[model samples]
Target: MEAKKRTKIIDVLGSTSVGTQVLVKGWVRTFRNNQFIALNDGSTINNIQGVVDFTTTDEKILKRITTGACISITGEVVESKGKGQSVEIKVDQLEILGDADADKYPLQPKRHSLEFLREIAHLRVRTNTFSAIYRMRHAMIFAVHKFFTEKGFFNIHTPIITGSDAEGAGEMFKVTNLDLENLPKTVEGHIDFKEDFFGKETNLTVSGQLEVETACMALSEVYTFGPTFRAENSNTSRHLAEFWMIEPEMAFYDINDNMDLAEEFLKYLTNYALDNCKDDLEFLNNRAVEEDKQKPQQERAEMTLLERLKFVVENDFVRLTYTEAIDILKNSKPNKKKKFQYLINEWGADLQSEHERYLVEKHFKKPVILCDYPKDIKAFYMRLNEDGKTVAAMDVLFPGIGEIIGGAQREERYDVLKGKIEKMGIPEEDLWWYMDLRKFGSAPHSGFGLGFERLMLFVTGMGNIRDVIPFPRTPDNAEF
Candidate 1:
């Protein structure tokens, strides 16, 4: 006999064919009163209820149905006699696919703390909160590609292993094949990278911006969405050793055009989530509201998740120069009262997350695009302003986590870029090919990088960046 095709819990619940027969498979969320089963297959946040006749079904088989147990139920669809859901499965044939010893399973029917859930990250998605997040994550990822492709941008795959440090941050995970336990050193006592796999030193890429910019030289509009590694030794809620980034490079665009694109792109993504992932968003929004209520009243979110997303989509971002922001920060209540953790004492001070959040959540009451940052603080390739004091750089600040996207207009001048490279102490040979873009035919190109995890945090209302990613690689935690 041919095997029965399994119907998804989402489809089963959506059907009006009350007497239609179907096969459903999912992990049991709960086995209530030994008759009703709350089943989910990660299709949606909500679960499909399965009703079984306890009097007729074998008690031995019923005993195996517990929380986290995988089961296949062949039954007829019927209108739910319950309140929460409209339809349920009437089980005629039930089989335990995988029995979960209720006592051994990490997940329970009750609400599990986020901190506790992180310990079992592998099984966390089986729960309602994480299942919703991963589903929404898929929608966001799809929307990212959809948005860029619709904008006439060619998607490019940049290499993960590279020789040059794009950000000049100096913190990178070196890619190698040489036996570390053994020894290979040069006469200078430095590890001989020349003898390594790549014949020269190579590290996991920190940013695909530099490489994608090369493609922009010919493609006119190109973007890269891929993993980026940073070996920064910080284990903060916001920091991650490995994260994904979405970078778009345009050959003829300037800083102003970059800002406009960033705003539109963000709005498009949030709108996509609102439209495509409404069920998941609604669950996450309620979760955020409940989470917020536990916090001190003054420390709670001023706007709920849905409202926050709408604020970005419905309103124009407030744009100002870095100098203007500095002046405002200096005179602001937090700075005057010495409440800021990092006081705004100078014009060239790097704006931290606190400062960025202040500009967005408190001062502007809307998303803000900050431009014209001090040249010294920004990347070397950023366009040098006429005044020679700042660069044509811009950072888009959102309400919850502050800076979500950072970009700048490229310094197209060969001499100027070369000078900035030297001044920064970066080897000229390391970026010889990058300089060639300027040498051959460089236009006033511009691009910005949106941290995918940070965007996920804002979209899902998740607190830690680690929770937003499936397997978070932090400072030392790489366990599966």
Candidate 2:
């Protein structure tokens, strides 16, 4: 007899050509009644049910069919009489690829806490929750490239190791080959980088904005989607030692243009998730609803996951100047500012997360774009506004979370950029190439960065930012 070809669980479930022999290979999620098996291969959130005839099957073979064991089964596809599934497998052959002791396995059939799952990050994807989260994670990544590609933007691979501090945040992870025990020293007793790799101090890039902007000067529209690192010691749920950023830079675009792209890009991705990851989102939606029941009423999200996604697509984002937002925070009807628990009177004060939450959830009741922030609070690359105190920057805020996306129009003038670099105490020589762009053919350019995990957090309705990414790198947690 000719061998049957392997079929994915998703494809097999949707296949109308039933009663044909097909090979199903995956890890066993559950074995019940000594005759049924729940199998999944990370193809989707759902599993394909395998029905075994225990009367005819060997006792030794059945004993080895435990949870977390890898197995291969050749079965005939048939219409499922069971609920919640379309098709199932009638097992004619069974072989255990690997055996996992039920007691020794980290994952069993029962519900596992997210905290416990983090310890076994390698195996978390086997669960329905993480499988759905990752499927959507993949869909979002594909949608990002599709959206930009359809808009004539070229995807540029930026360097992971860089010699410049693009954000001037000074929270970068340094990269060096110098021995700490016997380091090369300068005449002034400072560490000498000239003798080390790159012949100068370098670090894992905090952002690819600088390099992508250079591509934008020539390509007109370019984007960088890659891993970035930060050496900050913040152990909050919102901070990560390493994360992915989607930064798109465009030439001849101002702050207004930047806002337009940011809004469109976000909506595109959200709508894409709704269309592509319907089953996955439905699972996550239920997951979030159940997770919220354990939280206090005041801490619960007002909207469900699906509702939150639609909220952004169905509503228009409110745009206002930073000063205008502060004014509303102080004088809005119902006295939202009075209950803010902090002063919003200062003109140059950085808007905290609470302030942003008020604007999105309480006051505006929709997404909000706070624009033209005070220059002192923004990066040095942002275009200085006409008032001389503010920069042409904007942040896109969502209902559940405050700031989801941030961008700004670049400072095109060489002298202004040079002065800002010098004023910030950044060595002008470190960014000589960046200065050259401004000196030669600098044009009005703008870009925004969407933290990939942040978007995933909102999309998946995951509270901890660590849960969204596969292998999270936090302050004190780097295992697996």
Candidate 3:
């Protein structure tokens, strides 16, 4: 006879199809009471219990049903009498597809610290915390695409390697195929970039905003979602050497318009995760609550994960100028008492993470959008304000995550942009094409770059950026 068709554990556990013989395959989470097994196939966090008759079942088969062991169960689905689950499998037959030596398996059916899980990154996804995080990551990604698609924005693919520095931050990872053992030097003994593959210096792109703007000029609205790299050596929990970024550029948009789109996009994503990934969110929310219990009272989050997400979606973000923010921080208790590592003493000083957290978490007590930053502190492409001292830049700061979105109304005047480029000492020749967009057909355009992992950190209540991303790439660490 042909073998019974296989069914996923999610389907079997979620449905009320009784008296049906279904084959379910998954790893054994635990073997309880010697006759009941909790099986999970990563379809959901909740595991289905498989009931076995210890009187007839072979002792050897039961002994192999340990944690992390893969097994196939041909059983009848029936209403469960368990406390937490509604249904379970009444096993007619059980076969061990793969045995996980209980003594050797790294993952046991117990709580593991996030740091320990990072060491065993490959196997961490099977854990309840990671599984829930990754599932929510997928939901957030889908929500990003859906929000832009519904808004009629064209999703544009930008090149990964380029010869230009869009942000002008000079923190780019060099991309070259030249043999480092051998030397290609000029008359002055400087390494010659002309001998490189691109004929000039090239590096992994830091942002796709510049290229996306060219597309937006014609398409009206365009966005690029791709991996971006930075060569910064900071090993903080928030920094990543390689991360995904979402940049949306729109023509005919000023600073205010950019802020509006960003706010709406974030709110939509929060609502989407609440609706689509309810189970995963609940698990993560509870996990966060448990994790917070170990910390001191002051260090814990004021609101739960679910409540925080809801708060962002339901409330309007506070908007203020960078000057106002600086004033607030200068007068705040931290600055007054010298509690801040970098004191906010002046108006043009760039706000550090601690200052930003204060503005969002304490001062405003909501999401804060601070615009019109000092021109010297912002990028060269940002539109300069009428005062000629500040640029129309905006940063959306969240309670726990500082500066989740950074963008500005772009400088569209050809002469003004060229002047800024020259003033900043950026190679005018390398950015001739970028300048061309402003030369031929210039329009008021604004855009912002959202760090995808940073958003994931907020949505999942994950303290470290590495936990949200599947495989994190950081300074001196690239292990799978």
Candidate 4:
């Protein structure tokens, strides 16, 4: 009989089948003394260390191989001397699949800055940190589907090219096909929208809330998990010109239900990543902890990836209305001392990132749901509260990540929605279909859009939004 194939790192550790032969294929992460090859098969989060002797393998072949080269080998699973791991592979036969030039390749065995890695985004995934992050991102996508599908929510696909601005922020990236040379110009020397591809102005969607709302009214429960774009020029670590958002719309739900769903969904995702991506999390923990130790003690005291996730899983999130949060900020020591970058003075002003981070991380010390924002500060679609000044909107702020999810209970009353639309200077004719939802059979509906990349940042303890995503699209930095 042919020799039994080698087992995977995950299976070798789990099974009682030691001293068995296995076949493995992976890229060489690192090589030591021309004897051991650190192999990762992409089958599991951890790589298997393959110890090979040059006496058995051809010296010419072994000398030709280098870092980042793909190889296949047959080996025996044996006990390892590695500090953290238990098993390693002793290889008998080896084949080099690809050759990577040692001098030309950008990724060396040593550490590289995040900024430098981002410059080579195409090749960064091969690194340990990025490999783990990308895998965690994939796991989160599965968790999102699993969480919603288990709850009987339908996954709906909204249009990418939309005619209406969902957020009314006027930050849309326009979709146009009119030639620039002999452009169809009006008598006033302005580009004519009538000559555009869509005949009217169109843009890449900023949010799918409005489209999902229409579907929610029909499907009862629906979600749009896709890319959203904005043309804002801000270059903060948190903001991306294009990002992924998971927007779930539910029929017959109020603002309270919206908060509950957001909390539950976030917890579900955190739990999912903790359970499914243990090895990846372990890799991330080692790196983050090492980096944290080099920082000041005060900064290092913030929650680790595992600890933050456990906190979310174990505790019930604190929920506060915008008015109550304002009162707390008014009476708080941070505001009194003027420690934050932006002041939290009144209820009508939008909450700054620093204030939101302070409330959740410093004061609350956990995830906090801030709801019932000022009507004038929020979008026109939000339901007006009984106080007439605040809208039934909510933003879920985590310890390190502020405003991971933003949503609201939509206004279902036709006349009220119409009046607000008109007063907000939004062309009433554009939202006729939205108003018709209320006229026909609109029920109390609520939903939230969780920035998927931001959620990944929360899961991986990644400091920036750009680091979590594969190919970040920021203003003036669209290099693929």
TM-scores for every predicted model: 0.98, 0.97, 0.97, 0.96
Q: What are the lDDT scores of the predictions, listed in order?
A: 0.93, 0.91, 0.91, 0.86
Output the better candidate (2/4) by TM-score.
2
Whose lDDT is greatest here? 1
Which regions of candidate 1 are displaced past 4 Å?
1-3
Q: Give the worst 10-residue stretch by lDDT in candidate 1.
A: 1-10
lDDT of 3 by residue, 1-480 (tens): 212888887788777488877898999999988999999998888898999999999999999999999999988888899889888889989999999999999999898888899899999999989988888888888999999999999999999999888888899999898889996999999989899988888999999999889899999999999999999999899999999999999999999999999999999998999999888999999989999999999889888999889878878999999999988999999999999999988888988889998988888888989999999999999999999999999999987788899999999999899899889899899988899999888999999999999999999999999899888899889997
RMSD each, Å: 1.4, 1.5, 1.5, 1.8
Cα lDDT tens digits, model 2, 1-480, are 223777888888776367778898899999999998999888877889999999999999999999999999998888889998888989999999999998899898888999999999999998999999989999999999999999999999999999998888898898999898999999999999998989999999999999998899999999999999999999888999999999999999989999999999999999999999998999999988998899999888889999999999998999999999988877755344376656676678777778888899888888999999999989999999998999999999997778999999999999999999999999988888888899887899999999999999988889899899999998888888
Question: In model 4, where is the ten-residue run with the lowest total lDDT?
Answer: 1-10
Better candidate number, 1 or 2, judged by lDDT: 1
Sequence-dependent TM-score of model 3: 0.97
Give the winner by lDDT: 3 or 4.
3
Q: What is the number of backbone collisions in each predicted candidate, taken in the order shown?
A: 0, 0, 0, 3
User: For residue 21, what is the lDDT in candidate 2?
Assistant: 83
Sequence-dependent TM-score of model 4: 0.96
Q: 1 or 2, which is superior by TM-score?
A: 1
Using TM-score as the measure, which candidate wins?
Answer: 1
Report the C-alpha lDDT of model 1 over 1-480, residue by residue, as the tens digit: 222999887887776477888898999999999999999999888899999999999999999999999999988888888999988988999999999998899898888998898889999999878999899889999999999999999999999999989999999998999998985999999999889989999999999999999999999999999999999999889999999999999989989999999999999999999999988999999999999999998889989999999989988999999999999999999999999999999899999999999999889899999999999898999999999999999999998889999999999999999999988899999899999999998789999999999999999999999999998999769979
Q: Model 3 residue 239 lDDT? A: 92
